[model samples]
Target chain A: MIVARTGNEAMAEAMRQVNPDVVAAYPITPATEIVQIFSSFVHDGLVDTKFVAVESEHSAMSACIGAAAAGARVMTGTASQGLALMHEMLFIAAALRLPIVLCVVNRSLSAPINIHCDHSDTLASRDSGWIQIYTENSQEAYDSVIQAVKISERALLPVMVTIDGFIISHGMERIDILDDREVREYLGEPPKRPNLLDIDKPITMGPLDLQDYFFEHKRSEIEGMNTSLPHIEAVAREYKERFGRYYPVIDTYRIDDAEVAVMAMGSAAGTAKVVVDRMREKGKKVGLIRMRVVRPFPKNYLKELIQGFAAVGIMDRSDTLSTLGGHLYVETRAVLYRASHQPPIKNYIYGLGGRDISLEEIEEIFEEVLEIGKSGKVTEPVVYKGVRE
Target chain B: MPSLKELIKKQDLLSGGHRACAGCGATIIVRQVLLAAQYPVVVGASTGCLEVVTTIFPYTAWKVPFIHSAFENVAATIAGVETGYRALKEKGKIKEEIRFIAFGGDGGTYDIGLQALSGAIERGHRMLYICYNNQAYMNTGIQRSSATPYCAHTTTSPAGKVIPGKPQFRKDLTEIVIAHDIPYAAQASLAYWNDLTKKVQKALEVDGPSFINVLSVCPLGWGVPSDMTVEIARLAVETCFWPLYEYENGKYIINRKPREKKPIEEFLKKQNRFRHIFRHPDRDKIIARIQKEIDRRWERLLKRAG
Candidate 1:
């Protein structure tokens, strides 16, 4: 069905259709409406989800872990500090191999305590062993959440699907949603594993692994992430076949024939694409690579994608605070180290703490990259874009 | 209620040869609770003595379904499991009736896990939460916990020249849980196996959340011989240091009222943790204070039971 809905509404609508067996959540801003709306759905009997109005985000994630371990299709929504609060359990969920689908509306972390759009919150948790998929807008947010369920289950890894806070969460846009029956059919039955609830064949979960087997167990977990790309691609392909839209881990726009390309994620990719189109109309060879899945790093795809570009500019909405540039810049730079012909990649840290990154600013970045592309010379590897010095 | 023979004959869900120390009261409590459980059960243990000893990787003491997900969240975790079971059962995916139980040490219950326990109880998940109250953080080598009794010397709240021992009284967690207005909440002792198992059965039979705080004895942490675990626990009940009581259907019930409550020293003198108080210059004063507190609490319970 075609409907005009906010990103939060879209995610909630998808959650309703997914009709998860359990959803334990605590509310936080920007992501609050998703659970609020879903809880109302539960009250109205629109879905059979067991909604737990937990007291805190820590319990919310902890509950999700428990439900997931109990062999139920489980999901929850949180953002910013809520995600930060769920930090420890996030690693445990991944380690336990429980495929919990977490919907994250991207927002800034605290210091000055801002509840605004930024990648800092999710970016800080990049090493938490969760499969992170950044969405460009409400439509993608709606689609990615459903896809995340399948990907997470297929790969036996928890998936974090994020849309920019307020920009997409509170902003309304036209999005096509799958019918409830279609979603039900697409997902089929919740995948079965040796769960905690199995009465006869009893199993022990989250056992204390000392030095003897902790390393081997962690190695297997790493291997789970390593070989998960195929599982991700398989689900995306199946979703495309079932529905008309398709989303890849590395989403590219006009990057095939461009001399200068820019990398962006979440909503910034939308603005970058508009600039890419505008620059293309004026005969500027510029392109965009939107990172959908950040964890497991998409190393091979990234390597293949950046092969021919003369110069690439990476747009990061959150700074690493390490003076080592942003997360994407450092990761993308590292991924290109083994490339035969390396591009002079510059990092543009922009739109931090919900600050807007204008198309004109993106155009300016493309212009700089285009200059570097033509000159075959590099300068200023990291620039804090759109913020006054 | 089932007789001791009948209860023991039902099932031995906890396998033998676990790594728990000798006379660990937490394991005894676990066995009683699991044996009393009528339906198919899934158990959760917090990161404490019971969890570490029972669920070491590749070897588990549990013969029934078990999960140990970090300390301080076992209540929340079991709430989720119960909810999950409900959802699955409603969906026709799960057929059998399954009871959920979470076992947390006092440190995981009265201290760090207090919030999660409160939340779980308030939400009223149909699960039984048991706190093995062994006084201190026994799993972490006798650190001070809110559950540790006043004048008991733990590693963190050690008795010194300037200070007596743990300055504050132990948290009344059973009363705190009762404040949540849950259907069943109780205090039990391992010395009274029948009472402990009966309370577990009562808790598991409740349609809403239930909690039982068992007086678990740790020989190593409490500075007692392994053989004195049950005897020391009995002394606690006999002296009114740990009352045997329950809150059910909005009424308080003192399960066992001693004919003549003994002095607190009978319980305290047996353990080295309280030895400093017996030898201190203010020994009479400290002992009087401890006895007064217990008397005050017991009187309050008697009034509530009326």
Candidate 2:
């Protein structure tokens, strides 16, 4: 069915079709409407979902851990401070190996309390052991929520589906939503595991381990992440065949033989895609790559995606507060080191606190990358896009 | 409800092979609560000694489905499980009746876990949250908690040169939970098995959220001899220091009131934690103040009960 809906509404729409056993969440800006709308759906009997309106996001994720541990397909949504509040439980959700789907409407973390779009919130929790998937538009946002359930459940790890808070969550767009029956059949029954609540075969979850087993458990978690990559690819393939929506680890646009390429994640990628087309029309060899599955950190796909580029401009919506650049920039550089070919990569930090990055700014970034391509050297590996200094 | 003897015989859900401390009142409370539950239960424990000692990988004593989540949020975790059970039952998935119970230490319930507990109760999930109050954070080695009583000596509230013990009185967490206006809330003690078991059964039977603050004993944390766990806890109830009461449907009922209340000194002197107050320069003054405060609180509770 085709409908005009905001990203939050579309996520709620997908949730209705997936029909999880329970969803626990606390209301927070930008992401609040997702659960609020889902609660209304429960009230209207649109879905048989148990909506747990928890007082805080910490409880929200904690509840998801319990529900998911009981072998129920569980989900929740949060943004910014909500995600931060859930930080401790996020690791527990992963370590307990429960497949709870978390929708993160990416927003800036607070000091003075900003509610705008930034990758800081999710990036800060990147090591929480959740499979992080970024979406560029409402359609991908909707699709990710559905596929994330399968991925997380299959991998026995929690999944975080993120989109820019104000940019995508509140912005309305026309997209094709799956038929409820199709979605139901596609998801089918949630796979059963030995549950914490199962009376017949009781199992213990999240026990303390000091020296004997902590290392082994962590190594096993690393194995869990390694095992999820193929599952992600397989699910994406099945989704493409069923819904005609294609999502690879990285979405490459006109990068086949480009001399200069720009990298973006989430909504900024769409804005950069427009600039990519404009630069190509002007006879400039500039392309764009939108990274989708960041948690598994598809370094090889990224290395392969930027294959023919001489100079690449990596646009980071959030700064990592580290020595040189953002998290994506550092990881991208490190990954490309083993790629058999190293491109001169320049990092561009932009769109912080919902700061708008116009097409002209993106065009200028491509021009910079082109200049770097000519020189074959990146004098400034990191540049603040719109900052005064 | 099962008779005390019958309940004792019912397969011990918390098995014997686990490693709870000797004369651990919290573990006994867990066992009794499980005995009274009518439905098959899934137990959740906060990150504490009970959780750490019981399910230390490859040697879990929990015969029933048990889970240990983060230290705080045990209530939230069980609330979520209860929510899932409702959905599953509605979908014709769960046929048997299942109950959810969460256990937490004093620190887990009264301090960091407070918000999550409040949220879960306010949201009205059908589950029983049992706070095994041992006065302080016994899990992390007896640091003073909000549930730690006044003038109690803990690691954080050491009775040293300038101070007595924990300076302030313990926060009334039972009243705090009652403030949410949940379906049922109560205070019980491990020593009062009949009263505690009855309250646990009623809590499990409640259709909405229920909370029980079980004033449990801790040999290590409370600095009492292991054999004195029961004696100390019984004296606590007899002295009105930890009253046995219940609140249901907006009405309060004092379940067990001592015919003649005993002196608070009996309860205080049994524990080494309170050993210092007896030798302090102002010993008489402090002991009288403690007795007077207990008397005042007991009278206030009686007025409410009346």
Candidate 3:
């Protein structure tokens, strides 16, 4: 059975189904509702889970590490500065291989601080060894979270499920939630003895790797992450079989015969989808390809998907240090260079710090991609869209 | 005295074969704390010497459930873990007895991690926070920390002809923890394992936040011979430099009192970091004044413990 619910409710419902042993969290803007709803479930006795009220975001992730270490399926939520505060532990969680699932309501990092939708927060932690996934709508956000648990546990890697702050996180939208029985059946029995907690068979975790062993240890983490791709797809397939909801690592919208395809992720992809629909109706060949899994990046699949296209426009909400290059554009270019067939790619930096990204802006992005394709030339690394200055 | 065999031999929570430097004081304290703790204990460690030596990807020294968080969140993390355990116990999901403990270095507990520690104490979480006070940021190559004693030479606070070592006295973290009026707080040293063990047991028995400031000597950072780690720690207390005491329910108790206080030079001469103090007579007076401060604090503690 499917119920129409908001993003927060969908997340809470998914968590209730999983029945995480521990939920450690401190309230932050946009991400607070996820914890608030879960707290209510704890209060109402709907879910049997430990709800830890931490003092700050740092403590939230810290407590999560302890709980996850103790072989508990631990879940936590944060955004923006909160995510930044947990930066140190993010690396620890990955290194420890605790399979902690974090819900990140993507928000702008501070300085000239703004608490709204953007990829800056998660992007800052791009190299923190977490499998990062971005969702475009309430449904994807809900489904990705459950799928994340399966992928993380199976692969023994932590997963971060990101939804745009105040956009998908706060926006009320109709979402299909899998029934409790279906969710349980799909996820399967929680591991009776997590690798860290098997008392009979004592296994040491998170040991000090000296300079001689550090590279090999890091390489193993990479190998573990690389192994997660197939596991993610397999879990997604099982999810579809159990609940009739298809979740693709990369979702393409009307990109079959298109010359110019605009690529984006998170809620901005929703606007691009609408724009693509309108463009197709008007007899234009413009399309959209939304990236879901951003880490252990689906490079090979992305290369195949973009092979036939003449021009690809990469839209990003986060900046990479130096040269005004955005993170997505850098990864996309790298993937295209390694692919058998390549395409002309133009980078667009937009919708930063929760600035409104409208369908009209996406249409404009589509037009710009076409212009770049015709010219067969690109100027600066980053082209500002819907901005003054 | 309880025979070592009679004491409950805990399954090595922090197993051996880890890559801590030979005679690393922080690792010793961590191992001792884990052994002193009851079974089903959750450990939250801050990013410092103990954490660095124990946790590297795919090769943790810890056999128990161990967590290494940020430099400043150990107290908060343990508090949260305690909260989670309490919640689980109340819900009947968890039936086993468990305790929560946090380990941190001087830099983590006394400096960067102070706010989080204060918050955790104020919230009244049932946990013990042990600050392994090594006096400097030993993990990051001996930079001066707020807990560094006066006239102690660190990489950042070098004793040149003009400057004369770390001029400021070490921050009184135990007194600050005591001011919070938590259930229990104490100061211990790696030199006195029995006293430290007793303090840990007492703190575990307390219901609310318990703070333990352990004076852990860093041989590498302190410029002392590796084998002399325990000896230097002993001289620190004997010279009335690092007094051992406990504060319980607003009452003070001096755990280890030195009957005949030794000269401060005996402790200073063993460490090369304090070599400059002996070379310069004016700096010697500064070290002497610091030792006097320690003596004064010990006298006050004795009065309170009465």
Candidate 4:
């Protein structure tokens, strides 16, 4: 049914439909309402999930890992520092191959300590062997979470579904939610894996590995990610076939015949789309590419997408502070490296700590990229967009 | 409760031939607790001597379903496992009854993991959290932990020329756990197998979260011979330095009160960690202070247990 819901509301509704076996989470801003609403569902007996009101985010992720390893469908939500607190357990979860779903409301990391929307939290955890899916709006957030359960289970790797804090988490938008029975039918029964709860065939998990087998075990985990691309695509395809909304790893708009393109992720992609349409009406050959998945880097599809464009502007909500630009910018550049025709890509670090990214700034960015496309050269590679001197 | 003969007949959950140091009290404590559990149990261990030694890769001493998460969150991890079992059983997925237990060293339990333990118990998970209190961090080279007794020498809190051994008193973790008002909380010693096993059985039988602090003795960390682990542990109880007690349903029960408490020097002089206390210039005053503290605590415990 079509209903107006914020991103957090959409995620909570999806979690309710998923009706996981256990949810252990601590409260954090923007992401707190997702677990808060789900806990009420558990309280009202809408779902038979055992909601663990853990003391801290560290325990929240630890419990989720324990629950998932015990062979239960598990879900939790956190943001910024909460995700940062869960950093150590995140690697353990991925290394152990527990299919736990974490809903992250993207927020900036500390120092100045702002709870506003930024990609620093999830971006910093990029190498932690998780399947990261960034959503553009409330609808995408709802769809991606439901899809993440299937992907994580199939890949045997944990999945992180992120929405921009406050922008999507608090802002209400019209979204279509699937029926509860339909979601259950789509998800089907939980897989029977070798779990800690098994009595007759008892198994040991998360044991210490020394030099003898640690490298080989890590290599196998890398192989799990290496071979997960098809599983990710297959889940997205089946979800589209059943639910009628398709979300690919790399989604594009008006990029069929464009001289210049702007790449973005998360909620700002929605703003970029409007700017793209306005620029197109003004007869400027410009388009937009929104990256949905970041973890299993989507190198091949990204290379194919950025093939013909003379120049591209990459928008990053979080800076690496390494002077090498933001996470997306650095990774995208690495992915495009060694290509026969290298596009002069400019990195636009914008909207950090939830500073607004307006249409005017994006239009200016497109104009600069369009100029770069014309000259086939780049003067400045990395620009801290919209920041005061 | 099973007799000693019956318990011995039960399958050994923790297999032998692991990498633990000889006479490691934590391993013995684990064997005793697992033997006492009547139901099929899923065990979790925080990063510590028990975890690293028992479950080295390519070889795991654990015969039961086991998990070793990070250092400070085993209580939370097992709480999750218990919650998972409940959820699954409610869904008619798991039919059999399975108990959950978590093991942590003194460092994992009293210091870094204390918050997680408190939270798990307060949330009322039906699991048993056993802390193998070896007084210090035994796995990472004898560092001082909050559970280290007063004036005990550790690598971090050495008996240097300036300041003696560990200056602070050990944290009474069992009392702290009792304040959570859990269904069962107890202090047991590795030397007393019967009392330790009985407490484990009682803890596993409780309907809500239970905690047992087992006073584990580390031969390496305590600077004692491998064969002296249990004897040193027994001296700790006899000297009234570490009492055997239990708190259940708002009642404190002193299980083993020494008939005539031994002098603190007997317990202190056996280990090299406390040897510095003997040769120090203020040795008499230091010994008196230790005895005074032990007497004061023992009297308070007797008053409560009465």
Candidate 5:
């Protein structure tokens, strides 16, 4: 049954449904409620799971890796510097194919050291071999976590479900949560892979791969990721069938017959969607495309989706290789490289380091997209609605 | 009387054919520890010489369920694993008896990993953490670590005209672990396999967190011949440089003692890292001071064990 709950409660309920055997976590702001509510379940005997109170974020991820390697369903939550501290093990977890599911309360990486919402933390760990999914709100946070576990176990790759810190992690909202039995039947039992700890059939995992075999091993990881596309869609379909909530890997809001589309992710997409709705009411042919799965690229899907658009304004909270380019712009261009009907893409680097990306700012970005479509070559990178120097 | 052999499991959890360097004391210690553990044991290994050598992608040497976490989180990882096992057992999901053990190098345990180790012990988790004290970071090309003995040459702390080996003395990780007042803490070496095995078995039998500091000799790091690894470790104990002892419930017990104490130079002469000390007579005073410090610590341990 659907119950109105906050993101943290939705996450906790989803974890209860997944029934992870071990939950090792340390409390951090924004991510604490996820663990706090889960701990209550452990205390009340609502869930038969071990709740480890680790000393630091490093230990939290380490403990999860250990439990996961030992053939137990393991989950943990962290943010910002905590995610950075767990960076090394994240790669190990993926390489080991442990199927660990991590809920990342997305926080800004340090420098000015803000603890609020941003995509930089998860963005920095893009190449860590984890299948990353960005959630726009509490409902997505809960729903995506269940989907993440199914995808990770099926692909034999770890998954990270990211919700913007404070914006979605701390923001209270009504979210639908499926019953434990329904979730159990939907996700089924975690697929039995060759675990590191199985005594009867002993298998060695995480072996040293020198230059000779390292390439092949890396290629296999890529193969596993490539294989995840169908499995992720299948899991999402299963979730929708069981719980009556639909979520696509890439959710397009009013993009059909549109001249301009704002591409973004996380809670910023919510604001962008509102701006798109307002622009549509004013007789403007603009829409929003929210990227759900950031990793495994979804290049082919994006190429198909952006085929008929006149101009695509890619809004990113992260910078890419080029000074003026954003990560979204780079991926979008790479996906649309040989397409016949590729749109003229404009890069907009905004909402970095937890700075507010309000609805007004999204409107301003939409205005830039309109101006750029008319001019053809308006400006390089066009830092839209940026904080004035 | 229970036979010491009966205390060990017949199954070889950490098998052979791994890519550890020849005469690797750390590899031997891991095997010994695994043999001493009961069935359904979970192992948490830190990133070190043994971990890097054994777990290379899709090829593991470990027969038991093992995890290789970051350098600083082995103890904490094991503690969490133990907690999971406890919860599972209480819920009747896990019916078999299980033990949790963590392994780390001196660089990981004595320095970078100390905080996590401290937290695990303080939390009183049922696990055993063994620090294979190989003196330096052998995995990372023989860099200087806090466990490197004073007057010993390393890649980072090389003996030169201006500087003669590492200036700081080795950190006493055994004493530091013991100070936490855990039920069990000990120091062992590769030279005494039976004693090391017995200590591991005893640590596993304990209900709370136990720490073992093993003087694992690294031939390549110390610039000694691979064949002399065992002899080098033996001389270390005979010279009283690494005392073999155990602390149980506030009581100190020396497990082994040399019948005839050897001179520090005998141990120093085997390793090329310390060869410079003997060549220069001006460094005699430094060697003498190190010898004196070893002697003092040994006397203190003996008195406490009494």
Candidate 6:
């Protein structure tokens, strides 16, 4: 059924349906409502969850790691600073291979301490070994939470489902939700593992993997990440068959015959989509490719998709602080270097610290893409859009 | 209470063939704590002596479900597992009666992990938190931790040209845990095995949060002979440097009060950690000061116990 809810509300509803055994979280703005809403559901006795209101994001994630290690379906929520606080434990959670679903209301990291939307929060954790997914709106936020649970459990990897702060987080949209029974049946009893809270068969979880074995475990993660593509597609296929909704790893719009395209992730992708359609109506050969699953980053598929285009502009919401472009742009360029087609890619760093990326700015980005297509060379490699340089 | 025969006959949960140094007080605490536990247990340890030494790649010392996560969150981790147990038990998922316990060294417990332990106890989770108080960061090469006693020469708190080692008084972590007003909190040592084992039994059976701080000795860190570990811990107790007591539900009870408290020098002289203090220009004055601190703290314990 369709219901009007904020991204936080939709995510909370999805969490309710998923009805994990444990939720350990701390309140951080933008992301606070997700846990706050979940707390209310717990208070009402709607879900039999042991809600742990931890002191900090470190404790929140630690509790999740513990609960998840104890053979319970665990979940938590955080934002920029909260995720930052959870940084150390995030690596531990992934290395331990616990399927803890972390709902991140994506916000900018702190220096001057701004609590606004940016990819800096989750983007900073690209190497954290979590299966990261970004949603464009409340609908995708709701679906992504449920999908993340199944995907994390099936892959034996933690997942971070991100919704842009205030943009989609506080904003309302019509979300299509599945029945509680349907969602419960979809995530039936969590798949059992050899390492769990079983008394009969005891095992050690998260041992010190130093010099001799650390690399082998990391190699196993590489193997797990490589194996995730088929699992992601399989989950999505099952989700579509069961719920009548499709979620592509890297979603594309009007890119079939386009010579110029703009690639982005998160809520900004929606605005970029609008620009793509608007330019399409004006008979401009421009399109959009938005990434949903940013981690276990769809390398082969993204290369194949973008290789067809002559020129591409990558919209990065977070700065990498390097001479090389932003994190996503760098990864994209690295992958495309191996592809048959070498498109001249322009990197646009925009919407940092929650600055709105207007449609006009997106149109300008498409125009630049078209120019790069005709020029066959990227003169300006990096553009800090909408910011005073 | 289990008979001595039964306790001895109980299968050792922490197996042999681990890498802990010989005469390690912390490892003894683990073995005794596991023995005291009445039911099957799941354990979690912080990244310190117990964790690193217990598990490496293909081998693990634990026969129980042991989880080791980061340095500062053993309490939080065990609380989570306990919370999970409660949820699953409520849902009729966990059929057997299982207990939860957490282990950490002084570095993990008194310094880095204090906040997490505080949070876990404050939440009233059903788990026993055991701090194997080695008095310093033993695993990291004898660095100073909050639990490092005054005038003790650790690696970071070396007694150098101008000063004594660890000028500050050791933090009373047991009292800190008691401040959280958890269901049960206590202090014991390997010196008093009966007292420690009984406290462990009591803590394991508590329905809510329980904490036990054991002043375990570190031969390497304390610069004592490995064979003298238990004797030094005993001297620490006899000298009243480490009191044996329990605080449960707002009531303070001294478990063992020595009739004649030994001089603090009896404990100090057992280890080379305090050797430099004895060689100071004002050696007598320094010893008097250390004794005074120990005596004052002992008097406070008496006042609380009464």
Clashes of each: 0, 0, 7, 0, 7, 0
Residue B65, candidate 2: C-alpha displacement in angstroms: 0.7
Expressed as tens digits, the lDDT of each residue in A192-240 for candidate 3 is 5444333345454455567888888789988988888998899889888
Task: Estimate candidate 2's RMSD in Å.
Answer: 1.4
Candidate 2 C-alpha lDDT tens digits along A1-389: 88999999988888888889999998865455888888999999888788888888988998898888887889989999999999999888888888989888988888758899999999999998899999999999999899998898789889999988888999999989998888899899988887865688887777777688899999999889888899899999999999999899888889876887888899989998898888888888778888889999997778777756888889998888887688789889889888877888999999888889999999999998899989998787888898777
Instruction: Put down candidate 2 lDDT per residue, B198-281, tens digits, no spaces.
Output: 898898889988999998999988888898888889999999999999999988899889999999988888889999999999
The digit string of per-residue lDDT tens for model 5 on A248-279 reads 98998988867878899988899888888899
User: How well is each residue in B90-150 modelled by candidate 6, as lDDT tens digits?
Assistant: 8888898988999989889998898898888888898899999999898988999999888
**TM-scores, each model vs. reference:** 0.98, 0.98, 0.88, 0.99, 0.93, 0.99
Of the two candidates 3 and 4, the one with more favorable DockQ, higher being better, is 4
Best by DockQ: 4
- Among the numbered candidates, top lDDT falls to 4
Instruction: Write the number of the candidate with greater TM-score, choosing between 1 and 5.
Output: 1
lDDT score of residue B53 within candidate 1? 94
TM-score for chain B of each model, two decimals: 0.99, 0.98, 0.95, 0.99, 0.96, 0.98
Residue pairs clashing in model 6 are: none
Please give the distance, in angstroms, between residue A116's alpha carbon in candidate 1 and its true position after superposition. 0.8
Off by over 4 Å in 5: A1-4, A28-31, B1-22, B38-42, B52-65, B80-84, B87-93, B257-261
> Per-residue CA lDDT of candidate 5, range B68-167, in tens?
6677888876776677667556766566787878889998999889988998898888989999999999999998999999989999999988888998
True contacts kept of 5: 0.51
After superposition, which runs of candidate 6 have C-alpha atoms over 4 Å from their true positions? A29-31
DockQ-best of 4 and 5? 4
